[model samples]
Target chain A: MERCGLYLGCNIPLKAPDIEQSMRKVFPALGIEIVDLDGFSCCPAWGTAPSFDIDTWLVVAGRNIAIAEMKGVDLMTGCNSCFGVLSEAKHMIEEHPEKKAMVQEKLAKINKTYEGKTKVYHIAHILYKEIGLEKIRKSMKYKLDGFKIAIQPGCHILWPTKVMEVTEKNPFYPTMLKELCEALGAEAPYYSRLEYCCGMGALRSTDQEKSFLLVKEKLLSMKEEIDPDMIVTTCSSCYLQLDGAQKILKERGEIDFTIPVLYYTQLLALCMGFDAKEVASISEIPREEIIEKIQSEERAQ
Target chain B: MQVETVNLTQKDRKAVLAQMIEKGGGNLTKCIQCGACASVCPVAITGLPLYCKRLFRFLQTGHLEEILDDASSWACVACNRCTEICPRGVDPFHVVFAFRRIQAQELAIPASATTSLMNFYTTGHAVYGDASELRQKVGLDPVPPSTLKYPEALKELQTLLDESPMAELGLF
Candidate 1:
């Protein structure tokens, strides 16, 4: 069995455990072994902004990459923030000799070093590359004929464009996830603000009121215009901000909609004919609607 | 609280100003002090006392201490709101990032609260401790420790890092 290191950054383990479970169950079915890296920590959230210590951030991120390197497989992550930090750090080591030296010097105490040996890939990149969309199409057990889904490509996944291996300015830059959804037979809604940020980055940490306001704007617009049956995201942070903030918004009498938020993996698992219990276990969203949809389809068949 | 006074010589201020110009694309000098960046700044709108225009003025005048010391500098969401609305095309996001880099280099990290973020970079997994312990703490199922399956690959990585002089420095 071919193994790939699965890099699960902070939020997925604590806040969104179902995402981790879905990836574990589904990737193996797709012919990829999910391996873990010990002694790895956060990507320090984002890049080491000037106010933050560069060496510490680099060492912290470098150590994680080093752990993956220690395992000898390309690092695959589910979190966009983790992807961004690891990818950028890997790229920095590859591109700049001095920065690599500086970061390595700091890692020496921990007996770790980043020699730019491991390549970092997000789960979307892996699904699109390793388990090709055509293969995913062949694995689909159920077709999502009536479901309309909206794609929200969080900023970390899209920005600094080259790292993501997609065209940022274009509407279809994050086509892989959308394609995966379509291959499983769901309608992918194209909205005007599809490429806009969820504004859930540092905003959630520093200025939450502003963060919720941004979430409210995005969710309201997504509901009013696109009218997706569900909002599917790859980033765990985006999942929390969208799913958690929606409840907060409804409680405050701001909006009266409950658009289910799902990780792409859960949707894929459901389409692959996994049990609703297993699907619900891996999804933060309630599986009632999806279960009912599948059952109704079964009766029609 | 009284605002702390900053003292800098003309040469010192000019040097820092030149560095900011070179690193930030010379946009910091183009501010007409119009307050346009401030008027549109989202953080300022939230009543946080953070103004990109004021930050630019501080950079130009070499009064970076106040800007560097303030927690508001790190609060920028990189939303590009100010950058998009700036008539001068000044990229406040880049400015904020550059300032953040400077702060990180100076080792002035705040020490008020601990965040789980620290655990993310050290272990590829985010939470600290073993998977079972973390699972119990967070009320999740215990996941087995997932390591890379290939031993030869790990050996090669160790050799590569071992060859570099910087790796021997052991700063981490």
Candidate 2:
């Protein structure tokens, strides 16, 4: 089993470490060895690059990819922003030879050169392509047993259709994660806003009040149709928006609905028999009931 | 003292503006003034004139100063919802980012948020820098290492920062 570096990016390792842990556990079972790409920072999202300084964004992202190339493995990221940024940079470098030359020239100063050989894959792609939905089905230890989930595909992950390759109109395009949950015995509820953004993009960073209101509207819409036990997502930023923004809204005398947000890995961890505390730690949502449920199971055992 | 307007040359402004258009995924020059982007913009609807069309107009007119100074620019939530709905795929999110970069260069970010961002940049983590310190205080594991040291790379970045007129505006 060859190894691949997992580019945890800025958010998950800091704000959602459980996602990293769960991913580590699940990926190995799927035949991929997970390694860390040390020394990578924010990818800056959209903030680091000025109009004239896109070379810097390309160089930095290229350098991170170069680190994984050095390790002799493709990069796997759970963060949608990281995937989008790194993947886009890689595509740009490969497609434009002149741009690649300029980026390499700048990178030479840092002793980093991106040859554009490595591929960037989101965790979902790995689960679907490498792990195979059938293999995941066989590995299931516990079933979700009717867990209704709304798949909130972050904008960076499934949008612009040109990148990400995940289909928007077709419900089946993003069905790997949903199928993975089903394999473990959870029910994935399909909704119109299933492919919506959680409002965590540049908008959220710049205008938070407006961002929160927008997020509240999306969450309310999701709640209306699915009333899901939880909204599962692969993007940490979306998790923050759906989970943290909801709490922020409630504190501000907004709606009072408590919906726990879980990373797909955490849900997989639950089915794999990890304690809810361990799994829930990755979740932005509070973990009392989940912890209690796991505790009761422990007591029964 | 003679007050020269000190208008930035078209060449200099175009150099900076090109990056904004590319990153923003919008043709600042192509906006037809239909105001569709503005009409559907969640931020604009919330009473901020930071609509995509207006943002494009500001960038097109080289009114960087006005756009950067305006609070409406910061009101863009980067949700990219506007971009999705834009008949023209005019990404307001990217335009907002371009403004943020200007804010960083001008050292014009709100004082409170600047302090928080500075803490994260210096300490490597947002709330606190040292994982051990965070653990000692909060009884949690040390924060994972997301930042890697490339002295050579950072040195190169430092040069880029120094040359930038907006370098003085950066918190770090």
- Against the true structure, whose DockQ is highest? 2
* Tens digits of lDDT, candidate 2, A79-190: 8877877776776678789879977776676676568777888887777667777887676666566567777767566644444444445432556567766766568877
- For TM-score, the strongest prediction is 2
lDDT of each: 0.64, 0.64
User: Which number leads on lDDT?
Assistant: 1
Worst 10 residues of 2 chain A by lDDT: A292-301
Task: Give the Å shift of residue B154 in candidate 1.
Answer: 19
Candidate 1, residues A1-301: lDDT per residue as tens digits? 2688888876777556666777877899999988787634556565332224344455566877888787888788888878877765666566678878977776665577668777788888788778888888887777778788987767566655444443334423557667867877788877766655565656666667877877887888889887888888888778878888888888888998878888888778777776545444533345577556754556332
Query: Residue A174 deviation, candidate 1, in Å?
Result: 4.3
- Report each candidate's C-alpha RMSD, comma-separated, in the order given: 7.2, 6.4
lDDT of 2 at B1: 90
Q: B165, model 2: CA deviation in Å?
A: 7.3
